[model samples]
Target chain A: MSTIDVNGTAVEVDEEGYLVDLGSWTPEIGTALAKGDDCELTDNHWEVINFLREYYEEYQIAPAVRVLTKAIGKKLGKDKGNSKYLYELFPYGPAKQACKYAGLPKPTGCV
Target chain B: MSDVKKFLYVNRKQPYGTIYALESLEVVLIGAAFEQDVSLAFVDDGVYQLTKGQDPSGIGMKNFSPTYTALGDYDINKIYVEKESLEARGLTIDDLQHLTWEDEDEDWAEKDSIRVVSASEMAEIMDQQDIVLSF
Candidate 1:
């Protein structure tokens, strides 16, 4: 059994290393996740975080990078949906970081 | 505002031609900064984004595929590819670089971490998103 202290709260990890109670997550918890992981959330981080939360609600899952690009292009206009713009903002992994900030469970199958 | 929001970025364009692919990446990156939850679905020609070994130098374009590797730094890891799209395009997980396989020696399966679904499944995902941005 592995345990992670999130925002001073001890969270027990299951055998699979997933959170036992995913619902207990919150934005504050996400902030903690970023901090614990040493990721810095910049002004641009908000757009993807908000987008992921809404995306999860509709599909109950996180969108992969390719799909994310196309979707953003359609809604926010084509200019803001390309990979170059996305890399500039997240510079890491938009889906992973955004999911964490959205308080959603870590996306399955990510390394 | 209006509580946390959800967005679905639908990628449908080719890797080059237009700026659609790059623009979509920006929204997801910025959207995450805003604390929004984001997911992505690739359909039609959009599947090309996941293809591997792309050398854009001949066209005088930078190699954009490498940027996909940076998604983890930002924590945006959710990635999906339509199974049918892969088949239709004669693409397999092996054709793509970043994706992992269960067998590591075989084709992508349903159990693969990437959500490879049908057109209808993609549509369902779109309808559920608070905002569906297509490129």
Candidate 2:
């Protein structure tokens, strides 16, 4: 089984490897994670983060990178969909880093 | 450090074209690996991620949707879909695999416990979440 420590919180992994306690998260925790990564939360970051939260509430799963970009494009307009723009905001990788900062689990199929 | 936190993922794009879906899933899995609570929501064309019968081999890309099944391995359950999104895309609950469906007709009085919701309702969910990330 795999496990990770978030803000010193030791979380257990399930059989499929996902976390079991989603109700415990808070925005402040997400901000702390982003700060640890040297990222400054901005309005743009909030846009993506807010979007992901809503998405998860409805679907209960994470979106892959491809879907994330297209959705960003559609919602924020095409100018924001391009990889260049997304990468600029999340240098460590938009989908990966942003989801982490948002306090969500790591996305699937990532190395 | 005290406890794992809830993290929401919003998917709104198509299945292919970029690394949005793939990368987002990676983050979700990683979060789960760390013991954080994670959930996913599909809206707009993002719903395509759950569509059945995908064939990415022709395009030279791996069939990424298969990763959806792997999500359970990470314990990152709690997948959701927007009712309007499914209807707009002409997809039904049967078209999707490996997820719990929330019909549009379900109760929404509590707001937080709702599964299927309208676009606006989905937005409201985002607002209430401590952290929201859109992929």
Candidate 3:
């Protein structure tokens, strides 16, 4: 039962600060969520965020870390393909943290 | 609650009828990274999870039973099976895959992975665990 104000409008978020309503998500909401975690979103971070959002829209499920790493590698290049690189971009966990920012449900199963 | 507490995951369901057994195994595998004192207990129909010669291809399911053999590689070598449950189901040790893991402390000597315990012995194990998650 936590909420964060985005552009003077109160929006509901979950315990982990992920937006409760998927329809309520916006660029500002993403920025605010990242700021709450003391993370300033860089272009590289946004790249992953956008990728995850697109991936979810198509698959109806958030990609796990391994899947995300491979997809990123294919689209971005092998230089950014492995989990080690993704972990550096999202320190908490690429599959989890990035999905939260992307406004997707938490990935299930073994991540 | 202290981090890395003794955890006993009790499995009592069949493997594929529902996702419980697979999901529980997933959590156990995930929990291993924490290096906690983890023990897995199989009772009731859950004993079928370790049965050999499983071919789920007829059901269009990819057989994940082989993952049980790899559990030891993940340092999850402690598995307990309820003796009565298997006996009631007409299953014996010969019907189970003989899984073994190398003991790092024993200079990589291979050791049996599963231990058959009586109902009373399993109760003692459950009593000793700090956290018990049954599926």
Candidate 4:
């Protein structure tokens, strides 16, 4: 475990950079995490991150990438649902990277 | 002949009391990716896993009851709950969440995924599985 400073507030994070305490997440923390990877959080990115947070809130688990793709298609339209689109948003794997920003555990069944 | 094998996961433990329930759920989700014939059985204390309005926050455990609803999305639609188990615990089908899946071929028509069965019927179903894993 380590701590990441989000504007002077240190929050605990796991080795993989996932928030150790999910409740510690804020939009700032998310932005900081994205910044650490040299990636900017665009509205399109926030769309998926926010969706993951909401999905975790309702299902209590981060969805597998396949499930995420289908669900995104259902909610965000087919253009934004495919893995190609999701990969473009979170190139380091949609379920893993987006879930980390969303303060969720690595998706169940994610390799 | 189709190469798919019938797999039955037998869950008999209460959620959060042990790791078996969560482990079973994870395995089910992973195994579903293989496109095999998979089904789940809830008997004994396992019925509690499906009870609705579960809030494990006070217990410091993730409330995974909601995850059961995702099983339908994984194409694991055949969920068997033993009737005797529910009666012994003072729970009826109404106490559980209504889980369903959409049939794509049927124009996304929603269909129920849970089936309450007698203990004897559960045994008959178990007998038909190519693989039966108990937890």
- Listed in order, each prediction's TM-score against the native is 0.48, 0.48, 0.56, 0.92
Encode model 1's per-residue lDDT on B1-135: one tens digit a residue. 777667778898888888899778766655665566667788888889878888888999756665555454344545677778888888887887664223313431322335677878777777788888888
When 2 and 3 are scored with lDDT, the better candidate is 3
| Cα error of candidate 4 at position A7, Å | 2.1
> Where does the lowest 10-residue lDDT sum fall in candidate 3 chain B?
B67-76
Q: Report the C-alpha displacement of residue A1, candidate 4, in angstroms.
A: 2.8
- The local distance difference test score of model 3 is 0.82
Off by over 4 Å in 1: A1-111, B99-113
Give fnat, all candidates. 0.00, 0.17, 0.04, 0.75
Candidate 2 Cα lDDT to native: 0.70
Number of the top candidate by DockQ? 4
DockQ of 1: 0.03
Q: What is the lDDT of residue B28 in candidate 4?
A: 93
- lDDT of every predicted structure (CA atoms): 0.67, 0.70, 0.82, 0.91
Model 2 lDDT per residue over B1-135, tens place: 767677899999888887898877767765665666677888988889888788888999867676676464345556778999999988887788654222224531212222566788777767766678889
Model 2 interface Cα RMSD in Å: 9.5
Instruction: Look at candidate 1 and tell me the lDDT of residue B118.
Output: 80
TM-score of chain B of 4: 0.97
lDDT of 3 at B45: 95
Q: List model 3 lDDT by residue over B16-131, tens digit each.
A: 88999888977776666567788889999999999998888888875768767756655677899999999999999889988888775886689998999999999999999998
Order the candidate numbers by DockQ, best to worst.
4, 2, 3, 1
Best candidate, lDDT-wise?
4
Provide the TM-score of chain A alone for each candidate, in the order shown: 0.71, 0.78, 0.93, 0.96
